[model samples]
Target: MTLASTGTVIEVETRAGRVRGAWRGTPGEGGASAAFLGIPFAEPPVGDLRFAAPMPKRPWEGTLDALEYAPTAQRGDPGVTLIPEPSIPGDSTLNVNVFTPAPGKTTALPVLVYIHGGGYFAGSPASPWYDGAAFNRDGVVTVSISYRLGFDGFGWIEDAPLNRGVLDWMLALEWVRDNIAAFGGDPARVTIAGQSAGGGAVLTLLGMPAAQPLFEAVYCISGAAADVSVDEAEAFGRRLAEAGGVTPDRAGLSSLSEERVLELQKQLTAPAEGGNPLDGLRQFVDGGLTLGPVIDGDLVPLKTVDAIRSGIGADKPLVLGATDDEFSMILSEAKDKLRWIPSRYLLGKVGLTGKARSAYVAANRTVAKKGTAAIVGRYLTDRMFRTLALRIIHARGEAPTWLYRFSWTSPTFGMAVHCIDVPFFFDCLAADKVDAIAGDHPPQSLADAVHAGAVNFITTGDPGWPRYTAASGETRVYDDPSTVIRDGYAEVASLLPS
Candidate 1:
């Protein structure tokens, strides 16, 4: 075991080769850690490998200087999302960044493998907020992995494999299992976690029989499963091909320029021509994933919730939840436009008409008092995140599961908007751009509490919360003073079937 504290640079051996990393602070000071950046786990998915399953990187001689973040699957950062994640252009984007306090120690530590979320099309793993120094300081080796994104990773082709990104995740986990010991990590103590689409990826993997062997625990933060059916996958493939002026199969798709394909993807997501904009919003809410892992009846044989209900991943201890308003701010602008409209009418605009709408309104009566926009925003949160969490909890059926709700409202957004809770989860309030979303004076004490729970859960099976069960829906609500509620989701209970 090669300990990292002796110098500024540290060396560790991986299956592929030896790599050198830099230490952030002297070990004497608290919160010191070593950072190893851009260690490739797979070969560049370009040219012949483009649109194909990820391939492991071949062995290389000598020590690779892993000093900087690698290229990302995203062409370039769009700067539209709440996360300030950037993208560098390069083909060798499938890599992992490791941060550890005890490099190459025989005393194994827990591992946290995080996947970035961008609705399965965008997002980079190299964000400063994702740096593992904090987790490393807490005695856990942390790793952030990158995968093929968007059409190249998820677009369907007759001759190519489906869910290439999913395969990338599995391969990255295999790499961690194989080489993390060199970084003083226990592969057996690996905890896979992510937020939003990344959350959905972990949930999708949890339900997968083949993916069960990869990780021991899961901490899903606002997971939105994209159970794209084969037919839906085929439809989107044809539409993309039609817009690109190419055949939908591998031959024609492979021939189209990457730039052209990206253009077509935009067109596919473009609002319906000569149609109501409201209809587009409705479609976004009603339509499941247009891109992501598909239920191919083999790799992902069942819907994520269905697979859990059927006892898949029942033995793994799981902790899953979301913020109070994961996407509430999505309706902030629409609030004024919708103010005059009655809540019922606004609901109808989003396809929530008749008895079902009435039922949803009744279940979310508390939100109705906040006006139409609030109701709609909470509906989005519930429908897309919170409610799904309820479904998973009910389905777990005595599995050692814990539930939480990041109920602390953000001062910047005035609501616990999407991605707001991420900084708290990582305990990275000092990271760049955190003030933009979490306010200039975001609370570190909050970060301490939220991140402490995460560290506890990763290190031990329990997260210091009572396990949720069918009889008692125990939950930990992270607020100014985090509290435990016997039924944290009682309001959500009325939303799903008993």
Candidate 2:
């Protein structure tokens, strides 16, 4: 599958029949050796097909166009800088983008598949920042995929399927398993990498029986395996039904307009009288829509934390962590509202109190800069991200897990912020078509270092950092020019409720 001819459309035989992808040139006017775009991994999930498990795309008779990307899942206009646009109605939404060195007779190269994150709400694999042309330049096959989002993807309808979005990801992985060899990719050596919600997906996948054979390693930027519980999900369904002016029955709920459904989802983030916007509707427990992973017997049978604690996922290798201030992005509007709430009160929600709560708050206060805003942001970030990272690491005793904290704040925003590590990790300083997720332009060296670390982990099981275990308790702190390895990020980890 190596050595593709540059500047010619190469016929790729997919399960959906033959498609002609543009032949990326080798060091010519354009900077690609070989690449493919807009490849369909599953059938379109639109209209009657929406909310259903992904079905195989029916094969075509002639060559299908693979030059343009397919439409993505629906998203509201948040007006953020680097995020991608939502898919247009009636366009096929289940597709993949693959970049590979011309399939010239080269040896099998490691494959890296990227899943975009937007809290299970927004994001598409076709975002410009995700262009894998550079990875192809280094002889690694890269893939980015699209999946259903919002109520269309995560709503918990009792009669309908659960976790349809997660199912989409699994189907794409299966496609790679059955077809990636034609693109010079070794399916057995695949690495599933993602950030935020996508990172969470990686953790859930590790716990999923159906997802085990798809990849050998995983790299999660700032997500966890936890999601909304069945009870909470049903409540969200009721909310959606209420918004639609109907009863909370499956048929009644499914009849609502997509726009109306999204409006209900937006309300999930709105400040409530005494409730956190993310409290019950958020992905905290397993099983239900709204949550991406459920404890369905065949898909996911237990909480990811429980599975890791029980040694169910010990054989799998993991690279996971978060930005130093991952919650800064989410708190942009509620910074003031967050000021007086003590970390103790928040920690109590997760069931820790007295000495544990006091200790956690004190530790966070130390690292947090002197300012109400800074401390609050730091506290929230630790509660959400660092706590989860430490939980997964502490609970799992089988796999050799690498842990890290992204500490460099983007100069543009003056904070590392949520999703700030993405562009640098992808080496996408100049990539275009960014939506809400874009960050400041990164220095070439910064992108190189981050991407190198990620690629290193994908190619080899190590990311040039120490592994976190009960014994050594080592950690990696990733910054602009250097990646430092040390021990005991417990100051932040300790803040998590037990």
* TM-score of each candidate structure, all chains considered together: 0.96, 0.87
Model 2 regions more than 4 Å off: 1-8, 24-31, 76-82, 104-106, 246-250, 273-290, 329-354, 433-441
Model 1: residues with Cα > 4 Å off, grouped in runs: 1-7, 27-29
lDDT scores in order? 0.86, 0.71
lDDT for residue 6 in candidate 1, whole number 0-100? 42
Over 1-498, each residue of candidate 1 has an lDDT whose tens digit, in order, gives 122344588889999999998888885467778889999999998888988889999999999999889988887455346998898888799999999888878769999999988899989998888888788878889999998877888878888999999999999999999999999899989999998899999999999999888899999999998898899988889889887788888778888887788788878877879998667778887786688989999989999899999999999999999988887787788788788989898778877678777888887788898888898888778878988998998788878899999888888878888888888988888788888888888877888888999999999978888988877788899888888988887766645754
Q: What is the lDDT for 129 in model 1?
A: 81
lDDT of 2: 0.71
Which candidate ranks first by lDDT, i.e. highest?
Answer: 1
Q: How badly does each model clash, as a count of residue pairs?
A: 0, 24
Q: List, residue by residue over 1-498, the lDDT tens digit for candidate 2.
A: 123345676666766677777765654444465556777777777556766789878777988878776766755463232455445444578888888764533357899999888777776676667777767766678999888887777777767787888889999999888888877788898999988888888888877766888999888888845456666667787777777788775567657776777787778644476875545423232122254565555576677787667776677789888888776555556556656665455445444468865776677665444445565556567666777888888888757799888877666556778877787787766655322334444567766877888888888878887778676677777776566555547677566555
